[model samples]
Target chain A: MSDTSRTPTEVDDAALIERARREPEAFAEVFRRHAPEIQRYVTRRLGADPAEDVVADTFLAAFRQRERYDLSRSSARPWLYGIATNLIARHKRIEVHQLRVLERTGTDPVSDPFTERSDERLSARSVRQRLAAALASLPAGHRDALLLVAWGGLSYQEAAQALGVRIGTVRSRVNRARNKMRKELGGVDPTSSISEVHVRG
Target chain B: MDEMTQLDRLRSEIPTPELSGAAERRLLAEIATSSQPRPARRQRRRVNLGLGLASGLAAAVTMGVVITNGDSGDPGQTPTVQPYSMAAVTLQRAADNTSKQEELHPKPGQFLVFESQTMDPVDSNNENGHSRFLSRSKRTVWLPVDGSSLDGVLFMEVLPPKPYPGWPLPPEAKQEVGTRGPDRLADFDQRAEYLRTDYAYLSSLPTDTAGMRKHLYLELEPGARADYEAWDRVGSMLAEGYLPAAQRAALFRAAATIPGVETVKKSEDAAGREGVAVAMVSTEAGERQEYIFDLKTYQYLGQRTVVVDADKAEAPVGSVLTATALLKVSVADSAPVVNGG
Candidate 1:
C-alpha cells in the first residue's frame, strides 16, 4: 500500500525489471543502482575509451529487452554480464587482440601507473606477462566460462545460463581453463591477496 | 617468473578504467526523457557527433524511443577525428619494406627464438652517493609460438657483463640463489616464460593505416599528453611489438602522420649496428627515443633512449638510459639445450 517512493535498493532486479515493463521511466532507477558496477566490468574487459559506448549500449539493450528477462533470476548480474559479453564479442577481433596485447606486455592497457598503484604482489613483470599470454591463448568459449565465474562472480549454474551452455559444459570449460592456467603459471596459491581482489563485479 | 604469481597478478593488478560522473548523468538523463514508448521503425545507425564516445551506445536506446530523435541519419557509423601529419613517410617506407620480407610461418609446436644484448642502467651506491652505469649482457629467449600444453619456454644467459660485472639481482633472488659471483648461466625450470610475445594479437591490429592512427592517438592522449609524445609511443610500439605484416606496414604508414618526427640519415646504435634512424624528442622530459633501422632493408636494428638535456633528465647530457640490439629472430623446433652442470 505504501509503495509510492520505493528505493531501488529495497527491491530486487527482477522486480524492478517487471515494473519497467509498464512504467519505463522506472528503468532509470535500475541504471542508477547497477550502472557503475556494470560499467566497471565492461571497462575491465575493454579500455575506458570503448567502455563508454559499451556501458551505454548495455543498458539500452537491457532496457529494450526487459520483457524477455527471466523473472526467476533474483539478481541481474548474470544477465547483464551475458549482454556485456555479447557486445564485447561484437568486437571480437579487437577484444582478442587487446587481450593478447595485455598478455604479451604483462600489464593492463587500462592501468595508469600515475593514478593507480602498481600491484607489487604481481611478482614482477615477467610472471604477469606469462599470465596474460596464457589468458590470451585460451579458447573463446572456455575463457568466457572461466571469466564469468572468476571475474563475473557467477556460479557455475549461473555461468552456464549466461553462456547458454549446459552445466557440464561450464564445468569442463572452467576446469580446462583453470588447469591450463595452473600448468602454465605453476600451481597458483588460491589464498593469495591477488585472488581475493575480484570480490566485486 | 613463477606461474601462480602471474595468475594472481592478472586477477588483481590489472587496473579497470572508471566511468566519469558526467557520462553516467548523460545516460540517466537520456533515459529520464525518453521513457515513453514510440512507434517502431527501421533501426538506422545514428551517430551523435557531439558526444563521440557515447554515440554508439546512445544510438541503441535513442532508436527505439524519442531519444536523440533530432539528427536522423544512416545506420552504423560513428563520428571520427581527423589525422595529423608528421614523419609518417619514413615509418610507412620501413613498414612497406618489412612487410615485403618473406613471411616465416612457424608451426604451432615451434618457438620464436631471439638473441640480444640488453643494456640497462644499473644504479649502485658507493663512496660517492650513487652512479648509473650501463650494463650490457647477452640473453637468449625461446618463446612458444603456439598456445600449447608444453607450458614452457627457455631463458638463457649467453654472456654475463664482464668489464664492470653488473647484473642487478633482487635481494630475494640473491638470497634464494646464495651466490655472490656472476656465473650468469644457470639451469632453469622448463616452464619459465622469460620471453613474452603474442603473434595472435599482432595480426589483429587495424589493417588500415587510418584505423591504426585512431586507435593509438585516442588511447595515447590520457597517458602521454604531458610530454606531447603520443606519436613516439606509437612509433615505439611499432619498433618493439612484433606486429603482423599488413599491420606492421599500416603502423609505419600511421607513424608517418605523427607530428614532430625527425630523421637522421646515418646513425650508429649502442650495439654499433649501422642504420638510418627516426626519433622524437620530448622537450619537457629532455630525452629522445630513437628507433634505428637498416638503410638497405629498413629492418628494425634496435631502439635506445638518450638524454638531450641534463636539467630535465636530472643527469649529464648524452647519458643513455636504455638500449637493446636485436641479433637474430627465428623459429626453432625446440630450444637449444645447454648442460649447466
Candidate 2:
C-alpha cells in the first residue's frame, strides 16, 4: 500500500485533475475519491439499473474536459454534480414517473423506499405521496436547486457554482420547492385529522 | 411530528447505496484511459518514466480487467431506441420564435417564476394485472431573481393550483418538499431553477444549426458509436434547458439537420394544452419523445412522450408515458417563502 497521507484522497482534486492532464492515468485518483458517492447520488435519481452508467459517463466526461476544469476550484463535487444534473435531464420522464410512484406508494422503486412501520398513519403514507407528487410537480430548475442542498450536500454558493447560476437562484428555487412540499408533510390530510380519523375508527 | 422535523427525519432516512467492487475498479481504470483523446504515445513514455519513480505504486493501484460502461456496449445503440430526428420546418419556426423573444434581465432582488405540470403513467394490479393510466398534478413557483441584496435571493415557493385540494401544511416548518422520495438533486447537490442563463453564456452558444450540431455531435464522438440519435440531445438542449432566443433558434434549425424527422399535426401537452409537435422515435426503445410548439407562433409550449409500439415495451401502444407543460416564465418581486407561501 502506498502512503495513506499521500494517497489521491489526500491530494487536492484540482491538482489531481491537472496531474491527470499529463499522466492521463492520474485521473484514476479522481474516480477513486468520488465515484462511490456519485453512484449513490445517481442511483437515488435513476435507480440501480442505470446508476452505474451515469457514474461512468460523468467521470469520463469530466476526464474529457479535464483541461477546461477550473483549477481554482479545489473540490470537484460541484463540477461533477453539474454534469450529472445535465445528464439526469435526459431521464426527466423516468425520474418524474419514479417520484410520483414513490409519492403515491410511499416507496421508491430504486432505493429502499420507506421503513416498514405498522403503527404509522395511512394519512402519513398519503402525506409522503403528496410530498413526492409536489416535488414531481415542480419545474426542473427549482427541483435541482432544492435537491442539491437537501440530498447532494452542496451549499448554496457551491450549488450556484455548479449550476452556473447566481446564488439567489438556488435560494429561491429551494424556497419554491419547499413551499410546494410544505403542504404535504403535515401528518394528516387537511380533510381529516387524528381526531377525525379517530371518529372514523 | 412537526413538518420541518418530519422533513428532516425523512432526509436522514436515505439508505447508503450498496457498494460494488467491480464498479469501483472500473471507474478508476476508465479514468486512466480517458485522460486524453489519444493515449498510446504519451501513455508509453509516461508509463516508463513514471514507472521508475512510482514503480510498483502505479501497478499497486489495482489495475483490473473490468471495462468502463462508456468503452463499449452503449445502451443508446440498442435497436429499440431507434434513430431520432425532427422536422426542419418546425425547427426553423422554433428558431424564429427564439430570435423574437424579448431579452430579459431581472433587477436585483427580483425572482424568476416558473409554472408547470408533471404527468406520468400509473399502473395497478387490480385490473387483470394491468391498470395503466396517466396522472397529472399542477404546480406554481415564485422566486427571487438574481441581483445584489442585503441578504441575497433566499425566498421561493411552489404553490398548489387554485381550488387546491384544501390542505393544511405544517405550521412549525416554514416550507418543505420531496421530504420523502427520489431526490431531485440526488446527482450532485448543486441546485438552481434559473434555466434562463445570463446574456454572456447565451451569446456564446453556436448560433448556426450546422455549427451547433457539430459541437454537440463531437460530445459523442471518439467512439462514433451511434447515428442521428445525437440530434435528440441537441433538441433536448433547446427545449429542456436555458437558452436565449438566438441560441434556441439555432438549436431548432440544427435539429432540422437530423434524419428521420417527423411532425404530428395535433398533440396535447400534460396540461391538456393542444399544440403541434416536432418529434423523433426511438425504434429500439419503441417510443417517441417530442417538443410541442404553438401551431401558429411556434412558441414552445411543453414536451411529451408516447409508447408507439406497446408490444415491444411494457405499456399500451398509445399511452402517454410522460408529459410536461411549461405554462409561464416571468420576473417577480419576491418568491413564495416560509410564512408567506
Candidate 3:
C-alpha cells in the first residue's frame, strides 16, 4: 500500500497520522505550519479578537482529537478546515449581523483604499457595496462554502471535507450563493471580461 | 460612517496581531500537563506537528474514548469534594425593557432555584441523593405546585466530563469548555439548548414587581467557560432599570452592538416575564443560536440549561438546530444541599 513516500504536496494524510501517533510534539508542528494561513482566513472573516479565539479553539480541538485521525488522505487542510467551519458556525449570528450591518451602512471592518493601484477599483464603492450586500443576503451555508473556495482557495473536495458535507453539496451551495449574489448585484454579470478585471489577482 | 469604505479602510489600518506570547505560553503549558496519555508508537516518527490541523477529528475521537474510559464509573463514586462558588446567569426581556419595575413577585414557599448538573457527582450528597442530571439534549421544568413565592434567578450548570475536577481536561472536551482550565457548566456548547428552555420557562415562574429589574438568568451549567466579560455588558444593561426611557434605549443599543446576533422576538415568558428574546446565530452553519430573554419586573435570578444538541450536524438533515431541548427551574428548588455536611 502507498505510504508516506509520496511527494511533499502529495503526502498522504495517513502518514501524518502515523507520525503524530509516535511523536506528540509533531502536533505543534502542524499548528506552526497552518496557524498563519488559518489566522489569515479567520482574520478575514471575524476580525482579530474573535478570530484569535477561533484559531485557538481550532488548534486546541485538533490537538485533543488527534488520535482518531484517519490516514487515508494526504493533506490535513480539510480536517482543520472542518473544525474551523464548526467554530465559525458557533459565531454565525455575529458574522451575519455584522455582514448585514456592513451591507446597509457600507462598512468594512478591514477594507482599505490606499493599497490598491487601480483607480476604477478604488472608486467603485457602489459596486463593492452591491457585492457586499449581495454576499450578506445569501444564506449562511452558501456564504461560508463559497468564501472558503474563493478566498481560502480550497478545492471543491477539500472544501466539502472541511465542511463535513459531500462534494456535491459544496458545489450546489456555491452555485446557489453565486446566483443569489449576482441577482442582488443589480444584474452585474460576473462572467464577462469587465467583471473579470474586478476579480483578477 | 460609510460602512463599505470604512470596512475597507479599517482592513488596511490594522495589522492582524501575531499569536500573542502569553497566549502561546498558556496553550503550550496546557499541552504539557494535559491528562491525555500519548498512544504508544508503532512506527518511527514520520510526521511533525506541522500536520496539527488535520488530526482534529481523530484527536477528538481518541480523546473522547480516553477521557470516557479514564473517568467512567458511577458519577457518585467520588466522596471528596471542593468548594465551588455559586455564579448567576441572567437575561433581560421586553417587558422589563418597557416597564422599568418588577417582573416577578414570589409568593410564600416558592423561591428561585438554580442548579448545575454534572456528570461527576458534585459531592457524595448530591451524587447519592435526589439530584438529577439532565441529558445532553433534553430540558424540562418542574414548578412548585403550592404557588410558592417565585423570585430571583435559577441557574444550572451541566457540564461534560473532565479527567479530574477543577483542572485541565484532556484535549477532547477542552474546546467545548473553551480552555483547559476549570470552567462553570453554563459555558458549554450544550448550554445553548438549555438557554432556550430557560427563556421559555422563565415566563411561567412569577416575577416580583410590575417591571423592577426585569430579566431572566440563564446560569450556564457549572464548568462552562462562558464569555462572561462579553455577557456582562448585557447584564449591566438589564440591571439599570431605573434609567429614563431615552436612556433605556441606549441599553438596547449597547446590546445590538454585540456581534453575530439576530433579534428573534419580543414577548412575555411563560411566567409573564415580559422581555425581548434575541437570537444570536453563528456565522457557520449548524451552530446553535443563543436566545436571551431580557425581562422586566423580575430580579435577575440565575439560569440553567435543561438540554443540548446530541447528534452530528448532518444526522438531522435540513435541521440547523439539533434535537437539544431545555427547561429552567427556580434556584431555590434545584440548588443542591450537602445534608449538613
Candidate 4:
C-alpha cells in the first residue's frame, strides 16, 4: 500500500480532489485512476449490467462531495471504496441471488464471461460451489467485511475504513465469516481435491 | 483450502472491465458543467429576470428618480407623449394577438420544457484576481409542472465565449465550452411564493388585467423602484414561465401600465430576430431593459439589457450587458434520467 501510494508518476488523490474543487475537469484524473478497480469490485458483487451504473454513480457522488474530503488522507482508495460499498449495498438482493444461483447450479453468472479455459472451470467447480453457499449464507455485513479483505485486497484496517466500521468489528466479522465457510465445506481439505485435479490436468 | 483463499478464488476470473465510453462521457460532461460557478441566490433573480446576467453580472446601477419630461414650452410642436401611452398601445395589441394563439395545457405530473440561448457577463476571481468575460450557452430546462426549482432538470451546451466589451476574454472562459447536465437545475430554492414560475402556480394566477397588475406588484413597496420591480416581474414571467393565453394577455396588458415603459422602435433578440420592444430604464443601473415582441404578430421574442448611461453602467452607451432568446416551450411527459440510479 505504501509503495503504490508513492508511485513516482502519480499525484496524491487528495491533491487531485483539492484541485477538482477549483478546476472540476481535474476530477477525470481521479476517475481514470480508480474506476477500473471499482468497476471490477462492483462487477464481482453484482453482474456487469449494473456495474457500469453503480461505478458511474459512485464517482459522481464522490465528485459532488469532494469539497468535504479530508485532505489528511493522501490516498483516495479507502474513500472511493467506501462510496462503492455503500452503493453496492443498494443491490444486496442481486448479490445474494447470484451467489445462491452459483451454489445451486455450479455456474457463476458473475464470472461466466471471463472463464476461458474448460480445465480451470472443471477443477474449481466443487470448491467454487461450496464457497458460494458459504458466502450467500453469511449476513450482509459479515459478507462485506470478508470480501473487502479477500477479493478487494484491502487490509483489516482498510476494510474497516471502507465499511465505516471499527477495526474490531471488521476483525470479528471476518473471523466469523471464515468459520462459517469452513463448516460449509465440511471441514475437509479442499486443496487435496484440487491437487488430484491438477495432477490429471 | 482456507475460507479466505476459497473466497478469493470465487469470481476471481472476472477481470477489471474498462469504463464504458458512455459512462465516461457522462462523468466528463457533469464535471465540465459543474465547473461553471452556480449563480448566487441574488444572481438567480437576475437569471429569472431573463437578462442572462443572473450568474454573476452584478446589478451595479443605482436606483434613481424617473426623469419625466417637464417641458411644455413649444405649444405649436406635437404634444410630448408620455412613454407609457406608446408602451400601453403595443402591449394591448400583444394582449389581443395572444388571445388567439393555441395554448398548452400541461398536467400536474408533466414537465414544462424551456429551451433558450443566453449570453451574459461572467465574473471570475481566482489566481488571476478579478477578470470578466461574456459566457454564452444554449440551455434546455425541464421544470416540473407542480414543483419548485429544486425539481427541475437542466441540460446546457456551453458555447465559445466573447469578451465583455472593454475586458479581455479570460483564459478560464475557454476551458468550459461543452455540454453539461441533465442534472438538477438548482441545489436549493428559497424564492418568495409570488415569484414561483411553476406551471401549477402560473395557471392559478389571476387572468384579468387588474388582478394581474396587482399580482405583479405584490409585496412591493410603492415607488419608481417598485414600478421597476413590477416590470422586472413581467420579464421573469415571460422569460421562462408559461401562462395560459388569457393570463398571458392579462400580463402583457398589466405590463403596459408600468410608469416608465416606452416603446423602442427597433430591437434585436439574442437569435438576431428584429422586433419592436417596450423598455423601462433602471435609473440606478443606468441601463434600459427591453422586452422585444414580433412587429406584426405581437408575440414575445426575447429580452435584453443595454447600457444607457455609460458612466453608471461602466460600459460604452449602447453596449449590451445581457441578451436571451427563449426558443421553445413545450410539455414533456418526463425529464431525462442522468443519475442512472
Candidate 5:
C-alpha cells in the first residue's frame, strides 16, 4: 500500500504504534500522517460540523486500541479506515438524509462549495441526482461496501477487512449495489453523457 | 460508464478539509490525560483539580456532582435561608468584609494577572502498572480583560513531586521539575458564555444577592446537582477570577444559600495558611469541597478537596486530593514578551 511505502529514514505505522504504546506522545505522528484523508472522508459523508467530532473520536478510539493493532499489516490505512467507518456508521441517518436532499434538489450540499463554478457541474446534475437517489435507497451495509470500494479506493480485500466482513460478502454487496444503481439510471451510461457534454462545452 | 464511475462523479468536488486546530489540541490533551496512570479499580469519584484552564474546569465541575440516594433530601427544593447556620453567618461576614475591601479595576486594554500555587494528582504507567503522585506547581497567568480564554498567557514552574498519601513517588515524577512556557493558556475555549471569567464578563454580572444566586443556577437543572454546581461555579469564579466588590459580596452571600453548606472551624490552604472554611459535601465522591477564609479578616484564602470517606474516595480520610492558594491578583498593561517576541 502507498501508506507503507515510506522513505528509508521514516518509520512505518506499526513502529509508530509500538512507540506510542510506551510514549503516548508518539501517537501524534499517526494523527499527522492520516488526519487529512480521514477528515475528508468523514466530511464527504457527514458534512463539516459532525465530521470534526467523528474524526477526533475515531483517532482517540484508534489510539486507545493501538495495543491490539495487528502489526503484520504494515499499513495502518485499513485499520484507521475501519475505525472511521464505524464512527461514520453512528451518523447513518444524517448521511441518508443528505443524499435524499441531493436526489430531490439536484444540488449537493456537501459539494456546493467545490462545484460552485466547475465547468461540468451543470451538465452532470441529473447523473449526480440519480446516483444520490440510488445510493440513498440502498441498504446501509451495501452502500458501505460499495463506497468503501469506490470513493475510498479500497480493494475488495481491504474493504472486507475495513468492514469486518468476509470477502465474498463485500463482493456480493458491491455487485448488488451496482445493479441497483444501473436500474435507477435507466440502464443508460450516465458518465458517458456527462463526458460528451464536457467535450461539447 | 459503470455505476462505480457514476458514483464517483457525484459530490466528487467536496474538497478535503484541513483538520481543525481545536480538534487536534483536544485529541492531544486526551492522549496526555490517558497517558497518566489511574487507579486499577474504577474511580467512582470525579476529582476537580482545577489544573488546566476553564474548559477543563467546566467539565470537571459538571462531573463532580454525582447523585446520591435520599441523602440529598428533596431535589429542586429552594434552600431556605438558615440565618442561624454557622456557614451562613460566616459567609455573610465574609460578604461584609469583601464589600469593604479595595477592588482592582482592569480596563479593556489591560490584563488581569493572577499568581497562584497548586498541587494536583499526577499518575503515570510503564512496564510497572499505574503509579500516582502529587505534582505541585506555581503558575502566573495574564488574561486579557475583555477576551476569551484563548487570549490568555500562562507561565508555570513545576515544584518537586510529593507522594499521593500512600503511593510511592515514581522516578519519572521528577522529570518535569522545571519551568515551562509563558505560552497560550488554551487552544480553544468552548466554555459557555455564562461560565466566562474575563473581567468584562464578571463586571457585567448582577451585583445583588438574589440576582447573583439566580446567575449561579443559570441553565442548571433543578436538583441537588444544581446546588453542587452552583457551589462549583463560585469556586471557578473565585479561582483566577477578579470581580468588583459589589459582585464579590453578592457572590459570597449567594454561595451561603446553597444547600448542604456547613462550616469547618479549622482548614488549611495549599500555602499552609490555617483558616476557617465553608464547605459542601459531595456524598457521591465522599469528599468535601472547601473554600477557606482568613479567620479574623474573613478574607478569601484558597480552596481544597478533603476526603470524607476512605472507601469511596479511594484514599484515607482527610487526604487532600487537590489544593490551591490564590497568592496574588494585579492589573498589568501587557503580558511579558514570550518566545523572545
Candidate 6:
C-alpha cells in the first residue's frame, strides 16, 4: 500500500480508483464515503425507498465505469452527483405520477402524506404541489439543469457534465427554471418561498 | 438571489434516494463472484498477501471462505437481475415541432440505460458532438455484449496520473495518470497479460477459501493485469475505420477552438500508438479531447474525451471519440434520407 501519511487527496482518490479498477468490490470504499450524501440527496428528490434504489444504482454505475473516472480530479462527489442527476431525471414521469398519487393518497414513504402535520409537511405539500405544477410546466432542459444543480448539489460545471451541455447552457437552463418557478410562485423566488413554505408547515 | 443560497435551498428540497438491502446484497454478490474467480497456488499467495495487508505481519492465519449466496445456484438459474426504467419530460423542437426527449436515460445502451444530457467538455458550437458522460447507475440491465457479465465488466474512469507537487491548481485537482498511448499502452497490455496469467494460476487452485482470497487480490488490482479487456474496444476501433486518420488534425484544431482548451502536445501511447495528450483547464465549457492515429496508415484509431474535473467542470468530466467506421449508425426505416423528415 502507498504511504497513507504522505498520500495526497488526489493520490488517495487514485488508490481508491485503482482499487475500484482491479476489484469491483473496491468500489465499496468509495460508496461508503459518499453513500450518505448520495442517500440524502436521493431522499430529498425521491422518497426514502426510491432513494435507496437510486443510490445503489448510482454506485453500481460508478463501479462499472470506475475506469473511466478522471483521476485528474479526486472527489467523487461531482461524478456521483452527475450519475444521481441522470438517474433522477429518468424518473421524471414517475416523479409527477408520484406527486399526483401523493396528492390523492396523501402518503409518501419518507413523510406521512396522510397526516396533516403542521410542521415541514405543509410546506413540503405546498412545495410538492408547486413543484409538481412547476416541474410539469418546466421546459425539460431548464428543469433538468436546475434540479441537478439544486438538489444534486453539483456545481455548474458538474451539473453541465450531468446534462452534457456547455456551462453557459446550464447557466441559462438554471436561470430559466428559477425564473419560471419565481413567476409561478408569485415571483417569491425559490429560496424564500421554500423558507416560508417550511415555516407555515 | 445569491447562487449558493438558491442552490442550497434546492438541494435541501430534493433529497437523494436510497437502495433496497436485497438489491445492495445482490450487487455486492455479483461483483464478488464476477471480478474474483479463484484457483490454488495463487490462492496460497493471496492468503499470505491478505495476512500481510490485514495484520501487516504474517502470523496465525485462519482464512475463512464465506460464500454468502453461492450455495443456492442451480448453475442455470440465471440470476434474476433487476430491470431499469425511466421517465422524461419531452421537449418540443421549434423547427420540427416533434418533442425532443431531454435527460431521459442516464446511460443509453442495449440492456439498461440512463440517458442524460451530452457533456460539453469544451464549449465549441460543434453540433452532435458533446463530451457526455455515461454511467451504469441510471440503468440496471447487465450488458450482453461478448459474454461480458457484471463480473468481467471493466469501466474506465479517466483519471490524470500522479502529479508533481502543487498540481491541479486551486479549485481543481491536478490531472494524474495523464493519457496513455503506443509505448505505455503496450506496457499496459503487457501488464494485463501478466495479470491474466496470474489469474489463470489462481483459478487453477483447489476450491479453498485461501485460494479464493489470492484470486481476489489478483482480480482487485485492475492495473496488475496488462491485457485490458475494455481497451480492446479502443484497439478494435483503431483496426476499423470509424475514426479516419486525416480528420485527427481537424478534430484537434476544432478542439483547440473550444473556449477552455489548454496544453496540447504530440505524444506516444503506452502501447506505442501515436496520439496527442492535452491538459485542459476546468470550465463549464472546456471539454477534454483525445485522438489516436496510426502513424503508418494515417487512419484514425480512436478519439475520446473524458470529464477530468466535474466540480468546476461538467459531468462527462472526461470523454472519448471512437473511429467512425465501427459505429453502428442507426436510422429510422421510414425516416427521411437527409434529415429524417
Q: Model 4: share of native contacts present?
A: 0.58
- For residues B128-151, write the lDDT of model 1, one tens digit per residue: 222233334444445456543123
Determine the TM-score of chain B of model 4: 0.78
lDDT string for model 3 (B1-341, tens) is 23223224323333445655444543443343222222111000101111110111011111111112222222222112111110111223433354564334433344433221212111111111111111111111222323321211122222343332222333443333322212111111111221122222334323333222222223333221222223332432232112233334334444444434343233222122333334332222222232235444323321111111222221121111111111233324332221222
Global lDDT of each model?
0.52, 0.52, 0.39, 0.72, 0.71, 0.36
Summed backbone clashes in each candidate are 10, 23, 124, 4, 2, 121
Clashing pairs in 5: B37-B123, B37-B124
Docking class of 5: acceptable
**Ranking of all candidate structures by their DockQ, best first:** 5, 4, 6, 2, 1, 3
lDDT of 1 at B143: 48
The DockQ value obtained for model 2 is: 0.11
Range of the 10 consecutive residues with the lowest summed lDDT in candidate 2 chain A? A192-201
- Candidate DockQ values, in order, are 0.09, 0.11, 0.04, 0.21, 0.24, 0.12
Worst 10 residues of 4 chain B by lDDT: B59-68
Clashing pairs in 1: A103-A132, A185-B3, B45-B75, B45-B76, B86-B257, B87-B256, B88-B255, B88-B256, B88-B257, B89-B256
The CA lDDT at B308 in model 3 is 16
- Provide the lowest-lDDT 10-residue window in model 5 chain B: B58-67
User: What lDDT is reached at residue B120 by model 6?
Assistant: 11
Model 1 chain A: lowest-lDDT 10 consecutive positions: A192-201
What tens-digit string does per-residue lDDT give for candidate 6 at B1-341?
Answer: 54334434432433333434444443453334222111100011112222101010001100121111222222211112111110000000110121221211212222211111111111111113211211100101122212122211112122322111112222122231132211100001112221221222222333433332233334344441211222221222222111222222222232222232233233222222443333232232232333333433333323333334432222222222111111111211121121111
Off by over 4 Å in 4: A1-201, B1-82, B339-341
User: What's the lDDT for residue B208 in model 6?
Assistant: 36
What candidate 3 gets wrong by more than 4 Å, as runs, is: A1-14, A110-123, A187-201, B1-24, B36-341
